[model samples]
Target: MPGEITRFVLKISLILAVFGASAPVLAEDMLVIAHRGASGERPEHTLAAYELAIDQGADYVEPDLVVTKDLVLVARHENELSDTTDVGSREEFADRRRSKTIDGRLVSGWFAEDFTLAELRTLRAKERLPGIRPANTRYDGLYQVPTFAEIVQLVRAKEAETGRTIGLYPELKHPTFLLQDAGIDSVDLLVTALREAGLDGADAAVFVQCFEVGPLRRLDRLVDVKLVQLVNTNDGPADEPAMRYGDMVSPSGLAEIADYADAVGVNMNLLFGPEGIPSGLASDAQEAGLAVHAWTLRKENAYLPPVLRRGTAENGTGDVLGMVTILEAQGIDGVFTDDPGLVVSALAQ
Candidate 1:
């Protein structure tokens, strides 16, 4: 009987050697990332929005970073400030408006690159989706655009204050556009700021993300923090020389991405099939040793999958919890949502 017990132990040891002792515990808890800092409740990319998101129990808060004329890294969804700020109504800055081609499209607006950081401070944030969330309109024009350094400082202070680790997920928006139009390297500015704050290492509570592969590849070399390569389903314009986001989901493409990125941020549709069930994309990414974080899970019906949407009204409610459950089952590592409170509550259950 002793010999039999010894043999059993040997077998267990061999199995553990082959599979690794912690293999069974490798599964990560699904994270709730505040898409632009509980953006459903407050104007995005503002200090108030980020503070509100921390209060609501988000694991991370995302700030899409754009550069100003003076090379200051600021948080804004896009360099164009027409939609998310009151810049359009500012008569003093009306001359700043100009039509320029960005990302293969001609857009007329007050670009962030055209304004100095001090000039930008004169503008205030507004509700980007006031039609769906009219209540947010009341808080519009109350908050100022926050700098990347300011956001990092806020998160660090919050961590010390709350005793809970809060992470920052900042995306390099329109990298190609910034390079071509403004002749500024967004990644360099971002890395410099992070390094100054002592948040440039692999263990730092930060994730630098970008849609364009060029910037992310460059960032991978510049910073030690984790990087996420965002994947979109849309094809690039014919004249655009960049690779289409659709191609990045292929097995070979994912393997290539794993070479530089720690994770892949995909559109929710990439994870679903024609039947609206979870697809093999998540598993494929897992096979490539890449974490998957899906994006933009909003409460409004228009933003949800057809089957999950509740009422006919565009702004009506939807089965956000149901959608989240499906993604969790698909082995998603994190979810980006405008309503972080709802996602946090759903995950707890």
Candidate 2:
């Protein structure tokens, strides 16, 4: 009788410990999206970024895809090559350098549209913000610009090894600009590549994101996989002059989006309300039952919510704990951040 009692006590103790450990993680649904794959710790969109994010316990690693002239999909923030590479320094390809408008803004850089995938492969990927993060300069020309295919390979390996679903979230960057102007559309090409990698449709654990309504909606029509709509401070497409963010934040707009999309990816500033803090929800967003995923979080000062800024310094002072807490309270489904490890650790703590 005594031994049985002791064993029962130990079993009870173990159950209590597990419940305690799981309590914090169960408080809310917190999806850690490696914003451009742990970008705060590595050069964004490289294999190093994706690997580190997975290693750090990110639920999803986001890769933004743009097409090259040869129709190969490559991971990039935009079609432009200036900020993320040493392309500007190579005068041999100077003629390839030209200015173009993307989403109504005239950007001066070497666009991916100007280069074949083979030609782009010759250039190495580098830290996008060398000015703010000169330390990243040490790795300026080491890694290749990874393709969407490579990221799928990494995720496939993890899923096979662990039997846990590690997902890939690829944003179709500048879809309207790429489709109409560059003559390359992501709907067909990306879906096909994902299918090749065995990550197509809902069963594949791949979620596609896009800022323009038409592209994400178009993708929805093409595939059964989940679609995420990205909203920003920028203006809507020329055809949709009637719809803008100031108005989109209205109840009517969010509901319309909820009809087509599984989730809404909003700028952190707007969702959290510019205070460097997360506001619970805009009445409109909550009513729509649209899952909210906030974006572009970094450990940098420039991206920090205003409420968290302490000094006169222009950059981040590494104060992210309060913001995470606020996000938890706001009931966010997922967050896009350059430091997924930091976010995961904060939630765990």
| Total clashing pairs for each candidate | 0, 5
Expressed as tens digits, the lDDT of each residue in 232-291 for candidate 2 is 766764435577865666678888888888888888767643322223343357669777
Q: Pick the candidate with the highest TM-score.
A: 1
Cα lDDT, model 1, residue 193? 89
TM values, all candidates? 0.90, 0.87
lDDT of 1 by residue, 256-331 (tens): 9999999999989888766554457888898899999998799999898776677698988787777676676567
Model 1 misplaced stretches (Cα beyond 4 Å): 1-27, 236-242
Determine the C-alpha RMSD for candidate 2 after optimal superposition of all C-alphas.
8.9
> Candidate 2, after superposition: displacement of residue 91 in Å?
2.5
**After best superposition, candidate 2 residue 202: deviation in angstroms?**
2.0
